[model samples]
Target: MNETIQTILNRRSIRAYESRQIDEHELQEILLAGEYAPTAMGQQPWHFTVLQNPDLIEKLQTLCKASFLNSDNASLREIATREDFQVFYNAPTLVIISGNSKAIAPLQDCVLSMANMLLAATSLGIGSCWVHSPMMVYGSADGAASLSNIGIDFPKGYEPYAAAVFGYSAQPLPKAGPRNSDTVTMIR
Candidate 1:
């Protein structure tokens, strides 16, 4: 199998991270990989915000943690507002993927790009994760001021799409398992 396919098959979402930061070049390359993802109508109407500032990263973490911790849902509150909860899972960098809220299908495009970036990061020996849980706040201005502080327009019209955290992993990478037969469909 080719390396790209291998990367995809082998990729696993990392939730834990070490204390070190990824190099600026690697971060740029990962975002570049995301940019290459195909978009509907070629709108490319998405914005990529990379968080490299440690202080900012910490502040955002606190905000995310607070948001989750304050939720009324007992289960959700258990995850988000818990004393031990860390919004970014303590990862060193955050890549916020957002797009024109008005785009015909912004969520689909954003997810595709995020998937591309995740695969790219895996191939490069960088730790990464999809972070499906945080999209709840990223699209909300009251929720995502951290993105705005970095100069990314938190579009009241721009829907927050998805997010991925990148860094060096603190543990062994997991192996990909076989796909369940029930999950696949082939049409000719």
Candidate 2:
């Protein structure tokens, strides 16, 4: 298989990471990949928030944990109750993708962007995990307000649709899980 296909197959959702931050140049390349993702009507109505500060990342994690604890989902509450739970898995960098509310397909556009970023990160030997808890926390009005109070502000009319953490993997790359062959259908 070609390199792109190989990378796609090799990419996995990393859950553990090292303390060192990824290089600036590599991060820019990943962000560029996200920027190039296909957008609906070429609107490209997406904003990327890169959080590298340790304090801010911790604060956001705390907020997300609180949200989970208060959630009605028992699984979420159980996870939040763990004392060592870190929402971003202690990755040195967190990227939050947001989309303009007026865009034709904001959520889809943002998700595509996230997928590009994840692939890019994997290609660069960086570990990445798609984090959904942040969206769970920041999707609400109160959560947005709390984020604003902490100086993490999104562009006006833009709402977070996806988030992920990137860093050097502390553990060995995991093997790909077995795939089910029955999921696909032939249309032609």
Candidate 3:
């Protein structure tokens, strides 16, 4: 079996992160992998905003908190409050995926791209968490304006699709859950 394939199967999401930052070269490669993910209609309309500055990352987290507090969506806001209203998990790096809304496909396309980056980071001995909550801000006045304040801009229809935090693990990660047979099928 190919090593890359093995890495893919072995990777898992890591929640707790060390304070150390990732190497620049590794970060670049991870983003490069995201850029290479297949996009619908070959329209690679997504932009990746990599966050390395600690101060800036904190600001983004603050904005995320404010957005969650102001979200009209009841279920999400209730759950966020239960989680202590924290966002971004204080990881050393954040990658925000945004896309052109001229078409709706960009939303899913950008998500797949971010997913690729997450696996890539995990394979590189790093930890990653896919954050879907902050994305809600992209669709609102407070969140949209907040994103712009953090140097993330939209080209009219462009909006955030997803955000992920990555870094070295602070503790050992749990083994991946069993690949339950029910989730797979073989086509004759």
Candidate 4:
């Protein structure tokens, strides 16, 4: 199989990470990969906010958990209060992908960029996980204030669509699960 194909096949969402941070060059490469992702109508309406400060990461996780607990969703509140939960999985870096609120297919564009970043991280032997709780938290007023404090700014109408954590794996990741072929359809 081709190298790119192999990378895609082997990619996994890593939850446990070492305390060490990824190299600056590797992080740059991953960001560049996201920047090069194809967008609808060539409109790259996404902003990637990379946070490497451990203090900020901890603060964000705390804010996110608190926001989750305040939500009306009972399940989310329960999960947020769990002892084992860390929104960013203790990774040394967090990348928040936000999109222009008025752009066509902004969410899709952000997702494509995140996918590219994930693949790039995999190819570089870096562990990464897609995080959705930040998106949930950022939608709230207090979360917006926290983001502003952390220097994550969005244009008046922009919003966070996705987030990810990156670092070196602390343990070997589990194997990929069996594919569900039934989810696909063919017309040919």
Candidate 5:
């Protein structure tokens, strides 16, 4: 199989990671991959925030857990209360993809960038996982406040649309799970 195809196929959502940080060069390359992702209408309105600060990561995790615990949803609260729960799986790096909330197509653009970053990480022997929970915190008023606490500022009228944690895996990669064939349809 082609290397690109193989990378896509082999990509997995890694949850556990070693404390070791990914090399700065590799992180830059991954961000470059995200920057090169195709955008709709050529609107490259996305913003990438690469966070490597352990203290900031821990603060964000604390905020996320507090937000989850205060949720109206019981399941989220329960999970947040779990002794072993971690918002970013203790990964050494957090890459947040955000864009103008008022844009006509911000989410799609941000997600594509996220996909590119994931594939790039996989190709570089790094592990990654798409994390949606942070969006909840980012969208909330309190959560938005915490952004400034970490010295991260979104472009005016922009907010985090997606995020992922990247680092060296602490365990072996799991085998790819079965795909849902029924979801596809032949139109031709």
Candidate 6:
């Protein structure tokens, strides 16, 4: 298989990460890849917020945990109760993608951008996991205030759609699980 295909197959949602941050050059490449993702009507109505400060990441994690604890979803509450739980898996870098609310398909555009970034990170031998807690937390009024207090200011009319963490893996990559055979159908 070609390198791109190999990279896609090898990519996994990494949950544990080393303390060291990813290289700046590699991060730039990943963000560039995100920028190139397909957008609705070429609006490219998305904003990338990269958070590398450890203090800020810790604060965001705390906020996410608190939000999760208050969630009605038992799964979220259970996860939040874990003593070792870290919303971003303790990754050194977090990237939040926000989309213009007026765009044709803001959520889809932002999600595609995130997918590109994840693939790019995997190609660079970096681990990445799409963490949804940020979006969940940021959607609430309290969470919005907390995010603002921490200096995360999205462009006016833009709302966060996706968030992910990137870093070097602390453990060996796990083997891919078996694929579900009935999920796709060929129209031709």
Give the whole-model CA lDDT for all candidates, comma-separated.
Answer: 0.77, 0.94, 0.81, 0.90, 0.90, 0.93
Per-model TM-score, in order, reads: 0.86, 0.97, 0.84, 0.93, 0.95, 0.97
| Tens digit of per-residue lDDT, candidate 6, span 1-188 | 99999999999999999999899999999999999999999999999999999999998888898889888899999998998998888899999999999999999999999999999999999999999988988876687778999888899999999999999999789899999889988899
Q: What digit string (tens of lDDT, one per residue) describes model 2 on residues 82-157?
A: 9888889999999999899899999999999999999999999999999998789886549999898777899999
Off by over 4 Å in 3: 72-85, 178-181, 184-187
Q: Which candidate has the highest TM-score of all? A: 2
lDDT of 1 by residue, 2-92 (tens): 9878888888988789979988898889889889889989988788877767787676666566656566667767776456777677788
- Using TM-score as the measure, name the better of candidate 4 and candidate 5: 5
Two-way TM-score contest, 2 vs 4, winner: 2
* Alpha-carbon lDDT of model 1: 0.77
lDDT of 4 at 101: 82
- Kindly report which residue stretches of model 6 are placed more than 4 angstroms away from their true locations once superposed: none
- All candidates in order of TM-score, best leading: 2, 6, 5, 4, 1, 3
Candidate 5 residue spans exceeding 4 A from truth: none
**3 Cα displacement, candidate 1 (Å):** 1.2
Model 3 global lDDT (CA atoms, 0 to 1):
0.81
**1-188: candidate 4 lDDT, tens digit per residue:** 99999999989999999999899999999999999999989999988889898988887888888888889999989998899978788999999889998999999999999999999999999999999988878878677888788666777778999899999998797799999878978899
Give the number of colliding residue pairs in candidate 5: 0
In candidate 2, residue 47 scores what lDDT?
99
Stretches > 4 Å off in candidate 2: none
